[model samples]
Target: MTDAPLSGLPLPGLPLPGPLLPGPLVDDAWLAARLDDPRLVVLDATALLPSPGHDGDYSSGSGHAQWAERHIPGSRHADLTGELSDHEAPYHFAVPAPEALAAALQRLGVRDGSEVVAYDSGGGIWAARLWWMLRAISVPAAVLDGGLQAWEAAGRPVLGEQEEPAPAAAGPLTPVPLPHAWAALPDVDAVLRGERPGTLVCALPESGFDGSAPTRYSRRGHIPGSLNLPGRGLLDEAGRFLPRAELAARVGAVLDDAASPVVLYCGGGISAAGAALALTLLGRDDVTLYDGSLEEWSADPARPLVQQG
Candidate 1:
């Protein structure tokens, strides 16, 4: 890739990119104002894997622990790796079939035009996964910027318990389906080919950009011609996104030279969602993620892998 300056297109001050359907993202301030609106649906996305932390704290296990105790009023739990995912897959949290996804959303009371908001304790990475899934299904959705941390910082109310309403009965929201929505996915073949420019973005840390694998990927290198603007580069110490001005400056700096057709992918497509979140904030409408990411790419014995320092 070539070095470039900050981009000035689509204006610099917008909240998110342009291709993102409406409700790409909404901040705590915005959600706080509309928290009680019946049209709005909030989701809790905090998750902890079965693994324990140094302090013995479970990571992906936190969502249920927190949600069962207290959550934003009217918010439901959105499990990216759980209810919304498939464990019987080649990979975990592989996007569910459109029919299955729509059914899942309908259970949460999401209908045509239902305003959906998702947030995780993490800086909206997992949340954006859900947001992206919703987009795939053509559902209007947004992530809670800064996630629950921002909610707490704003002193917003959280609920420990709430009435569990009867699960609703509904079907897929969209009548039109993806040409391969159920089975279609970004594969190693296409990525190794590097068919699209600017769309194939890498959120890997610049410090380790020699194409070192970041644990999740099966191989030690990244796909060829990938963009480098690590998602972690977009965060502050508290695990929240940087201020809009700084975020724009950094994102614009990266995109200034980037060609177009933005496609983002990280170790496992997690952190890249953070960059996608940032791009959406910038108002760029063209963006897609290589879902299989390096994990799928590196695992392929036939695909080519490129490294940069």
Candidate 2:
């Protein structure tokens, strides 16, 4: 709401704001070295999706309990389905209002100059979602590649429930919206109807895209005219992203055509962020995420979702 800078010239340990994050995707090594840096704000943005056959209850699948049990040392838990999301929205994990988001991040110790690194317990989807949200609001942030699993694999020690640190004092943050970072229903509709020049990408798995797998959404398939590129496919066995060449090989066709922007969407916009992160790593900047994604698209009877041929 207020554009005023955070008061207090120098917080006890936090240094003055430094440069923006190195990039959108930071490795475990990059983060390990900066764990003690006052300017760095690490977050455990872990939110689990419902298991197969379970009710599609996003709230019930929150990762707060897992975060409370164990998490990256000095990192705060970001409740993606709760405080960080818009509860009143029809879709799960909807981005909250700018002011509300700023408030939430501030409460998590995000100051104007803070460089945030977000990681999750599962694949990097939740972390990428948080990174995308922060980027949309002009925050300098990055997702921890491979997430907490990689951190552990690298022998990084985590803090248990008994080792949790005291909550940091709230700080000031100003939200500067990046309009191009998001695509709404109208944007997707325009792209589908040939009124807009953009690529519609579905980040769901092959089965989900082809209507062969059970889905939590109202519909079984993907939006018509969308390309299939599973978000998880971009990762290697260790959950780290594949090398740049391999990443380009998988995503280049859809992204290389500079004539149109790439509009990415998924079940509820969570996995899509992972795809968006991949594109970012590939050095593609002309990408936008469909916020409501299929959860909103399929819910509408007027919208068409077609099975793969």
Candidate 3:
């Protein structure tokens, strides 16, 4: 009876290719059909951290290098940190400047109206981030449901060699992007500020009070008044998301009980996006992210922390 939360919105939602905008997520098979199509744009959104000590097994760089080495055969690279982030905010991979994003996509063969798909090897963290930004600006885009690992798991194929730039699409996207500013991130100041009057959920996992060395932070604790919600519960063994039935049950409890102004955070800003995206799929739109997260909070030297001692 009531209107669907995302019923008429043109800027965000699924892997929809509609009149006013594109979609937020897509499955692998849908993308496979148009892998090499010129009108379609496929941007690799892998984020690589330095390998722990292996022979370049699967860091983000290695993933890109691997892609160049072989991809869907013609997919272009969309560096998550560089192409999507402005680097001006404390959040490492926050959204990039609209003009910069437009130009970068153009260089990567993306033009207005081009169907875009982003993916990552690191459990969809980077992939979802890129997808979120594109949808924010009414760009037609989606995330490779399972991501690179799934692509590889399907025995699809990969490229370990460099290739030339893919051809550009016809729909040249205007730089008239939407704004996704955080209105200034929450710092140590946020913790001391007390909870907002309405509803909000803390996505941080509840750790045991037996604090050892502070693997979680510079201080080894959590923010004041935060309703601890472990992000790991949102994923399964292989690092992909849990089924919708399970996801709805878990997240719904929070939404039904916790306040509507849902705020997600992790050790840093990365994992929070995944949880938030999942919530978005569940049709809860009144959500915001505490960009600075516990890292910024603990490091500030002036914030109060509920340590597990």
Candidate 4:
């Protein structure tokens, strides 16, 4: 893995001009300095996951109430469960059509040239999900490295309901979809059948990946032939991404020459986005997210899954 930071130069697989942020991952200090920039749009893309034993749907909950209670200043809440997702899809948190996504983002004041920074109240998974979505549309966006926890740990001030800003006025955001950024069921099946060349990465926890933990899906374990890289292991105690050296040490061997395009998936595609963000930060732009992930994969009984020893 290269220690070099993502520069202004166009990324390898992503065909675009350049990113608005310095990199795909930004620290709280970096954001604090640009809070007042008119071109900047800060988003609180907080979505709560169901606890292991809970009976809630994977993408059932929103963090709007939590955001109303407290959030970063000047940040607007982006609804991942509702407007930002494809409600018509069979699985939860499915990526919406480009035009639908563009309209939803426009309602949140994302103009064509706007630079966005997304952060979640929990681990960076939800925020990364939004970042991945923005990337699919070729929008210039980045994730808040440590999320709300890190922001508060650094003594950054947060806004309460009383101090919240008014609803963002709509802006003109045209979607330029990058189809290659996503991997569909057929694509994954091809990889499983050995007809395609790619790496299948599962971002779930060890137990979830190995079928030891209870799951909401029709089956447990992971897609056959997947390599495990738990999303939680990608972060430090404070929920920030590990330093580049540490991150490289953890994922380098698994990814080193494994394949050209790395296909990532998790329970409902949320945690996989976190992995995707980590790989992007590591300068591996040849990453594609499985939008349906386990939710779609495990639903079909004909599809196979395997448990790790």
**Which stretches of model 3 miss by more than 4 angstroms?**
1-23, 37-39, 50-63, 167-172, 175-183, 186-217
1-309: candidate 4 lDDT, tens digit per residue: 112333343568987654448878888888887787666899999987766673223436888988988899999999998899998999989989999998898888888878899999889999999999999998899999889998998999998884446545566898998867999999999998889999899999998899887787778889988999988889999899998899998998677757878999999999999999999888988899999999899888889999763
What is the C-alpha local distance difference test score of each model?
Answer: 0.65, 0.85, 0.61, 0.86
Candidate 3: tens digits of C-alpha lDDT, residues 164-260: 5646643466766544323234432443465444333455555522223233455666666566555657777766677878989887776667744
The candidate with the higher lDDT, 2 or 4, is 4
Superposed by TM-score, candidate 2 places the C-alpha of residue 237 at a distance from the truth, in angstroms, of: 0.9
lDDT against true structure, model 2: 0.85
Candidate 4 lDDT score at position 295: 88
- lDDT, candidate 1, 143-208, per-residue tens: 877788888888988777746444333434662353322212344345436653344567868743
By descending TM-score, how would the candidates be arranged? 4, 2, 1, 3
Which 10-residue window of candidate 2 scores lowest in summed lDDT? 1-10
Alpha-carbon shift of residue 276 in model 4 (angstroms): 0.4
Instruction: State the weakest 10-residue window (summed lDDT) of model 1.
Output: 1-10
lDDT per residue for candidate 2 within 123-179, as digits (tens), equals 889999999999999999989889999999999988778444654665689999997
Give the Cα-based TM-score of candidate 1 against the true structure.
0.77
Work out the TM-score per prediction. 0.77, 0.90, 0.75, 0.91
